[model samples]
Target: MKHLSDNEKDTSRIAAALAEDLQPGNVLLLHGTLGMGKTVFARALIRALTGRPDIDVPSPTFTLVQTYDGLICPIYHYDLYRIEHPEEIFELGWDDALADGITIVEWPDRLGSYKPRLSLDITLSNADNDPNKREILIETNA
Candidate 1:
């Protein structure tokens, strides 16, 4: 599905809607360049799943991964941008997250061969050069 978000609020709404369909063992691959609102969507989705609209969902840039206890299951948010190699993901509990939790990965391209074959791919981009507008595309390969 394709969506045009006129502002951050719209983006968050879209993420919240998507969050309702998520389940354990589900992987979400977030694709976008710097400042493309990947983190914004992620934060909103995490909040929706946790039933904490005001929760602090920090980007896992430095830490590599952040875990949250969702309403239905665990949520694992990963930022692989700084990883030296995809093999390093194993040390971050990638397998465990995929086995029992919902995983949201930013910079999933860094996963290389470790990237899951089945996942929901969400791509975000600037819309018409508008800083507040975003073009989002969601695709599933399940």
Candidate 2:
């Protein structure tokens, strides 16, 4: 699906809509440049899934992975930008997370040949007409 967001609120609403269909064992691959609101959309989706608006959803840039426990099932958010090799994901327990929870990954191209089998891919891009506007595309290969 293609979604256009005029601002953060619109992005969140789209995220919420997507979140409604998410399930454990699902993988979400989010692609976007820095400051393109990838993490913003993630935060909204996480909150919608967990129904806990107070939960803090920080980008897992340096940490590689962050696990959230309050949701229906664990939510594993991973950022592979800093990973130099795809094998690093194995060291970080990628398989374990996939076996147990919903895994959302940023910079997933870093995974190389280790891509997950079933996943929702979301790509975000800036809109030329409005600085705050963004174009998001969501697709699934399941």
TM-score (all chains, Cα) for each model:
0.98, 0.94
Candidate 1, 73-137: lDDT as tens digits: 89999999999999999999898999999999999999999899999999999898888999999
- Scored against the true structure, residue 127 in model 1 reaches a CA lDDT of 91
| lDDT (0 to 1) per candidate | 0.96, 0.88
| TM-score for candidate 2 | 0.94
Candidate 1 — which residues are off by over 4 angstroms? none
Cand. 2 Cα-lDDT: 0.88
**Which RMSD values do the candidates have, in order?**
0.6, 1.2
- Candidate 2 structure quality by residue, lDDT tens digits, 84-111: 9999998887887888888888898999
- Model 1, backbone clash pairs (residues 3+ apart or across chains), number: 0
Q: Which candidate is the best by lDDT?
A: 1
Model 1: pairs clashing at backbone N, Cα or C within 3 Å: none
Q: 3 in model 1: Cα distance from truth in Å? A: 0.1
Please give the lDDT score at residue 31 for candidate 2.
94
